[model samples]
Target: MISNIMTMVRKELIDAARDKRSVMAGLYYAIGTPLMMCGMFMLLIGQMTSPEDLNIKIENSDNAPDLVKYLSSKGITHGDSQSTNDKGDQLDVKDIRLVISDDYAAQMAKGLSAEITLIADNSNEKLQKSIRRLERNLQTYSAEMGSLRLIARGIDPRVVQPIKVNVEDEATADSKGGVILGVATMTMIYAVFISGMNLAIDTSAGERERNSLALLLSHPVSTRNIVLAKVFSVTVFAMIGLLLTLIMSKISYAFVPWQELGFTVTISTEFILLMLLIGLPIALMAASLQLFVSFMAKSFKEAQSYLTLVLIVPMMLSMAASYNIAPDTLQWLPVSGQQQALIAFIKGREIPMLQLLLSSVTTLIIAIGLTLGMEKSLKSEKIVFGL
Candidate 1:
């Protein structure tokens, strides 16, 4: 059995190597995707840190001298103009500013509310939060001023507010880390699955379509050996892709200003090893599933269609899991569990060894089951024969 498996593995490698398309697909999957993802993550982190300078236009500066002073004290630069640059702009300020009309004080004194136009660049989501902060601060300042005026007029400020409440987050550091890592984990899964798909399909369905499967099957080799050989080759390529991604991610992280962000992300050696240990099983399972599906198809194009459907499973699961539906019973789910685990590891959490064992075992069991089923299909003349 060992000898037959070895022979099958050798044949699969030779065939894969000779096919330039298959070789290129493997290289791209194993190396290209990871590097791309690393670049993406770096960009995301950088944006989170030092956002672009916002150009803000504040109109009707005469009515809200206090508000203008407040904005100045916060070091938020703004221009006083009705039409700063663009009218269609969402916020009246480029970053976070409000424009008061020329008749603002007259309208307010007549028991009428005045209109404040805000122009902002909505493209930067981070800027929106800053705008909200500025607005909240202004609101508080206005309320405090009104309260002092009422007190001076012999009125109690407490009469206006019957209740007060404060909210706080009691979540642990791991849980908070989990939230950010979850997004990244989902992204990594996407990169790996997409990058690995073509290789998986070509290694199996492409081989069958080129009449290579028939030649391989005719040899004195067990079907299990053939499947294992193909899986191993595909996994090798997948690892290369994943490694390239990690290296790129590390480079991007290194270039980021960690002190400015108030937190450091040091990708440790141990983390990489653990990631590989977890990612390997996922790649094997993905490749095996694709290979099994490809074996059922008559042509490479048909196999490609089937593989595409298979790709959606991971993506859908990733999208759903990204919302972090919480680490409850659903955390034990296949793709969901893997997503949770990867996030837990990335955020410096000590993952439960049992969870990793269970996930790995479950994935391998499914892959082996599928591979065995494919073996049975291969032995049948009806399925193996081109009908």
Candidate 2:
């Protein structure tokens, strides 16, 4: 029986390998997604890390020369629409406008409150960080001037500062990198599903359509052995795709400027091994599920449609884990559970062994159930021939 299953597995693999559609489906995602993800991370990191100088329009600067000097010292400077940096590169000027009220320095002589108007589109996402920095510096200058005034009147400046706030961050560098890793991890997890999808459908629905499934089943092998063979073949293809994805990610991710985000994300060898270990059961479940769904469909086109919809289930689970949408229940669920454990491992946290074990067992059980169902369904002429 085992020999029959092995022979069936070899046959299925060779057949899938020769199918251009099946081979290309895994190749594209395994090779392409990591490079694409690397490019996206580079773009995001560039935006998050500011250049040495931040240029914006500052009107009526003479009204507060001291304030202007303070801002300049902090790398915030006034620039016209057409401004170039020392490198002769055109400066990317922010649209923020800071208008210093023209009171002719009269408010300072009387120790009274001064005013400044900042104009910009508050709803603009790109301008939010710059606007906040400008506001913070202005507040600092105001507080300093107020302290001088209190001292001049023989009052302690400390009287106004009744409370002092200090923050201590306890997060490790790995934990900080977790925010960036969320999406990266999601793409890797989905590799198992994507890499074997076309092959799973082809080996089942495509085989049936070509009048080959009936021939194969008519052989001296038990239906269970045939089901196991198909599942094993698809699972092997899925694992290979997953391994390639991890290798590509490891190579490509090194070029990203993770330091700009105040952390680093090195896909360590240990993490790679852990990911593979966890992914095996997921690959099996994916193969079994896809094969079962494909066998239930009458034709190749019908199977393709069904699998597309079926793929959404894993995607949703992965998405929820990535965005942290529903952590409480997802931590115990199948795909999401493994995802959370992977994320935890990436962040240098201890692996949640219980959850990992539970999820792996659950995933294998699902695969077994699906394989058995497919085996039972294969005996029915109506299901096998789509009559």
Candidate 3:
């Protein structure tokens, strides 16, 4: 049986080698992540940071020229929506309107509470940070004026404050941006699924469509051996893709300016080695899963569609793990559990060996279950002969 499986695997590998493009056909983002991901990450970091020149509509600038000048000093300036530049391009204007009270600075001269109304669509997600920034600046200006008033009256401004709060971050630089790294790890783990999908589909449905499956089945071999051979071949191809993904990550990660984003990510040799070792079971499960789905379809295109939808299960699981969502439950799930373990390792935290072992066992069991299913299905005339 072993010899039969090896022979079948050798033939399939040779066929795959003859068509390199189909064999290396990538999953999606991870495959093209060499340089594109770096640029994408740069954009993400920049967008997440607070903008420098905050522009908004000032309704009554004449009422408080002092406050308007203070705001302008902080780069918060009035902007008209219809304003244009030298090249006739529209200016970057926010829809926010800041309306000062019509008291003409009387409240401030009388040492009374001043009123400033900020108007904008609070529901606009893009303006949330900007609005908060404006509110903080206004509070700072109010506090400063109050402090001056207290000094003029021979009182200390600190007398009114009872407690001060300070927070210190204790996370190491390596572990600062864990969520981003988790997604990066997810992309690497997913390499196994997409890398072998084409070959898995071709080996099963493509064989049936070409009338070669029946001929292969007629040979002096058990269905178990055939199924095992297909799984092995696909797993091998998938691992190759995974290894390539790690290499690309190791190469491409250096180009990203992680320090500028207040974090650090290093794709060390140890991480690459560990990722490959961890990805083996995932590759097996992915291979068996893909082959099992492929054998159930009537055509290559139909199998492609089925597997595309089916792969979303693992993707969502990994994404949840990446974002640290529902970790208490996901930490025990199959794909997500293994991913959490990987993320922990990356963060320099001790791996939960027991959970990882249990997750690996469950993953292997799933692989075995799917492999047995493929064996049983390959014996059916409806599947093998397309009846």
Candidate 4:
């Protein structure tokens, strides 16, 4: 029985390998997605990191020469209309303007409040961080000036405060990159579904379309053996694709500027081993699910369409885990559960062993059930003939 199933598995793999469409579908995703993600992270890190110099428009500079000097000391200064950095690169200038009131220095001399207007589009997300930095500096300068005045008057500057608050952050660098790691891990989880999809559909519906399924089913092997063989073949393809994706991710992720985010996704050797360990059952479930769906379709195109809709369930589960939309329940679900575990591992946290075990058990159960259903369905002439 084992020899017969191995023979069937070898044949299915060889046939699938010959199908360029099946091979390329897995290759493209396994190779392309990680590189694409690296490029996106590079762009994102550049945008997120603060530049060495911040340049904005400062109106009525003479009215607040002292204030302008204070801002310059903080690396916030006015810029030329066509400003360039030391490297002659064009500066990323926020369109923020600071307008000093005409009587700004006079108010300070009279021991009264001074006024300045911050002008910028508050709705612009790109400018929000810069604008807030500028506001914080201004507030700090104002508080310093007030404290100096109180000290000169023989009064304690602490008189203005009724409460003192000190905040201590306990977040590790890995914790800061949780969102990015979650997204990265989600892509790896999805490889299981995508890498084997084409082969699964082709082996089932494609076989029927070519009028070969009936002939193959007529052999002496049991339907259960045939189902197992097919599932194993598809799973081999899925695992291969997943491993390729992980390798690509491990290499490509090294180039990303994760330090700017105060954390990194190293794709450690241990994590790779864990992913492969956890990904096996997912690959099996994915293979069975795809084959089961494809076998129900009358033709290759119909199977593709059905699988598209069917694959969404796993994708949604993975997405929920990635975005942390439903962690409580998804921790025990198949794709999402494994995703959360990988994310936890990346964040330098302990593995959720119970959830991982439950999800793995559930995954194997689904694969077995689907394989059995395919076995039963293959025995029905109406289904075998697509009647």
Model 3 misplaced regions, further than 4 Å: 27-30, 49-52, 59-75, 79-91, 99-107, 113-129, 156-176
In candidate 1, stretches whose alpha carbon ends up further than 4 angstroms from where it belongs are 29-35, 46-57, 72-138, 154-156, 169-179, 190-192, 257-261
Displacement of the residue 261 alpha carbon in candidate 2, Å: 4.1
- lDDT for model 2: 0.89
For every candidate, C-alpha RMSD to the true structure in Å: 5.1, 2.5, 3.2, 2.5
- Candidate 2: give the clashing pairs: none
Better of 1 and 4 by lDDT: 4
Clash pairs, model 3 backbone:
none
TM-score of 3: 0.87
Poorest 10 consecutive residues by lDDT, candidate 2: 171-180
The TM-score values for the models, in the order shown, are: 0.79, 0.90, 0.87, 0.90
Q: How many backbone clashes does candidate 2 have?
A: 0
Model 4 bad stretches (over 4 Å): 47-54, 73-75, 121-133, 260-263
lDDT of 4 at 109: 90
How many clashes in each candidate?
Answer: 14, 0, 0, 0
Error of 3 at 294 (Å): 1.0
TM-score (C-alpha, index-matched) for candidate 4: 0.90
